[model samples]
Target chain A: MSAVAALSYLVASVLFMSGLKMLSSPKTARKGNISASLGMLIAIVVTLTDEKILDYTFILAGLLTGSAVGVWFALRVQMTAMPQLVGVLNGFGGGASALVAFAEYIRISGDASLSVWTGDAPLDVLITLVLSILIGTVTIVGSMIASAKLHGVMRSAPILYPFQKQTNAAILVAAIVLGVLFVFDPSRWYLLVIIAGLAAILGVTSVIPIGGADMPVVISLMNSYSGLAGAMTGFVLSNNVLIISGTLVGTSGIILTNIMCKAMNRSLANVLFAGVGAEYDPSVQAVEQRTVIRYTPEDAATILESAQSVIIVPGYGLAVAQAQHALQELVNILTAKGMLVRYAIHPVAGRMPGHMNVLLAEANAPYDILMEMDQINDDFQNTDVALVIGANDVVNPAARYKKDSPLYGMPILNVDHARTVMVCKRSLNPGFAGEDNELFYNEKTMMVFGDAKETVTKLVQLMKS
Target chain B: MTEGLMISIYIFVLAAFVGVEVISKVPPLLHTPLMSGSNAISGITLVGSLIAAGEGHGGLSVILGFIAVVLATVNVVGGFLVTDRMLKMFKKEPQKKDQRA
Candidate 1:
């Protein structure tokens, strides 16, 4: 039976691999997801039928209740709330790992007759158990804080004070000490609980110092931690399927974290600790009084009509204004008029990686016209009009040269290079990075002040007329 | 470490490399789905959760294992369903037959 179970797990792991491989392309992504779910189902069924099963009531109830809640969340979530949803699911994954490790500890410790550490061929199960609990507890707490920030339940600003770094270090040190003590003496199981407590505190301290703009990096890192926690649990239980899948998730998270960090031209450490956008720099003067031409929808429409090529750049404000559908309508009208139109997506354009793409896809925009930053950036120079809707920092030219600016050294859309730049924004305020956009004041730029949805809708209506 | 532990370590190292290689090629367009999908795979801890819960140690272990099973199930089920929902949104270009000429 164990052999059969092992073979089934091998099959399940293969399914997960192929599922992930298929996810690399849009045409097969949905099928890939389905394939992975089938793998999960197979693993679950085989595990249940294995000889370890002494009863089934608790397992049945848990499966039913969890499925109901999971379906509820998956069905009702808005596309705009995707980051929070993912964060919550990550928390659950980590919480499960911690709980499973804790249960294993209680099981072994309750039966005093069996000594786990005495054999010359030690499994190091105790050490893995401690690590699983530690990493998993941290992931749960960190993911909750991140989700709260994304959902606007908590202040999105970085919560910092004197000695914050030192305080976090102390908590981590305390957790490690407790973990070591538990590993050495299995009788000291209470120490494991304390270690989890310290780990939970460390989770809060580490995540609270990151501001909302850096959430993509924080979430990716937490996702990695969740996977590491699972891997740790796999070692505790001697489970290969868990280890392989967990390592895969851990690697994916690291890759994404690296990509997001590179896009902002910031290292992972700076994103995690520097708290870059904590507050507006007081030294930067209030340049709000600087004047710029504010164009109406009608004038913007006229300029857009004559443009040979246009690149649409979107940001979080597009989600806030719920203007993706309106913008897509406008794109259809423009495309029909024999004008070349495409979207320019900065890697960090929104709160999460690929956030703008999800919103645009939800609005029914075809995938071919959506262009990543590296792909569409150069085309902006030859383009007649660069229409920036609800985006600021990504299009700011200061990133290229303003050394004193927080956004400096970061890659930005070359919107300023277009023959004409049309910006539709609610106001002339600086963006989330607290850096003023000089592109708004450029002679070639025209600022259309209004809600993004209203402005884009008017443009669509005008184009239709 | 036991031979089993050593083998597990080897598998972990090799799988990590495979993950980086396989995931690196995923286009930015499908990143959200990629994230959610991999998240579901991490829920493989559900296997451990089942063993623990079904063992029915008749005490705190059962309670903890039950909760673990529920949470792991939510991670697996919710992650895949949400990934599918998001991927379903990514429609390909409408057939460009009108411009073929």
Candidate 2:
């Protein structure tokens, strides 16, 4: 590589690092993204110059088509669909890495003069190549399934059959064995295709058993796999910029995954394998029979009018009903009436980490008022009204002491400590965790049944009158 | 071990540490954007795709490279653009007072 090209890559790597560092605060996040994109632009242009292309037709066509589609998707996607969009994009990145590795293999193996085994440690290159293909293929297929599940194309419930884990384990082991065999005898290249096939199956089987509520972890893990695949391809191509940038993304995903798992108070293995939210248990019928006072939105508004303080808890149901704007309107009205109003965000409240925040931000809610669980958990006790909007399991007090429940160990918001709890939900059904919420049955709790958007809008209207 | 592989390993290890350090500082408020933004960075695989496509390899290699390039570009462009869109919505507070000064 020329000195100029090497120096440019180094600069690009630095830009990526600085950009990520700047993301720590919202004030600089937009600028950080723009700078990182500039870095990408520099890397692409420098790479084009270095490769000495004989034909620009394919490159031009690919670039133009990709840009148009990418722009359309980015511009057209609703805030509620962000997780699905990210999942699809992650899949593309992984698929690209796998394809690049395959192309490299074809380029080298086809030319008798340039042997793949010519390097000092041929095994190193071969291993990297196999790893790239395996990881990349797995990431792409797994991401597609995950996105589909999130998009409602597949059932949100965990899909399980007998001996599922054992099957996934066997497929993985077989793929590894084949990968080693192919490394020894590169002649039987068909092994690569079989490995990719196994990877695709592994992707499906692995993601199918994870329920919708656990998508935050799955999405983050898939993001990590996509980056690791990129790094493996970097090793195959011996590209420093790719290695550095890919590793950065890989670690970022790993960190997010860890944080999500911690917030849910579950181990990574339990999240992946326990299939925690698989079925709505029959035991919930007992809780359903327990009597609870059902309140109207008018009543809720009256209750709110007298409250000195309010903390709103949002969950996935908010996104499903497209009620963020309505909820925000209610918040505005409450604030205008001289009541202290704030939003309490549970980490795993919605479909993904930061899901509720994104939806609320889209509704133009001020970032200052959106509080994390730890920041506001203690204040719930002093708050006059804890308005639960389209939320469930997160506020369930049973998690504090119910050992047999799936949510037993999971950290929940301290909404039960509030003076009065009002819940707006579609029905009395349990949440994705399938655990009946004890908070819903508490004496202080008031259940308001209806579409979240309609109920919140009614509350706003009533308060205005 | 080859000197090139050794250097790449060192770079990889150091970059991993840098990744953890920088990412840990990102608060949960920006976690969604962080996921999408770093996803764009992962599209660096486009570099390899470009090389594969531009080099006059074979029909199959060129085709594979072309598809790879397109996918990587989508990952790059979509990931960054969507992240920017989401981040744009995250305001510290509504613009009520002019503080241009």
Top DockQ: which candidate number? 2
lDDT of 2 by residue, A1-465 (tens): 788988999999999999999999999999999999999999999989974577878888888888888899899998889999899999999999999988887765765333343323367778988999999999999999999999999997899899988999999999999999989877666888899999999999999999998999999999999999999999988889999998999998899899999988899998888887876776756646778788998888888999999999998899899998878888888888899999999998776678788899988799999999999999999999999988888888778899988788888999989999999998888877787777887999999999999998888889889
DockQ for candidate 2, please give it: 0.68
Candidate 2 structure, TM-score to reference: 0.96
Candidate 2, Cα interface RMSD: 1.5
DockQ of every candidate structure: 0.63, 0.68
Clashes of 2: 0
> Candidate 2: where is the Cα deviation over 4 Å?
A110-121, A281-283, A286-288, B95-101
Interface RMSD, all models, one decimal each?
A: 1.6, 1.5
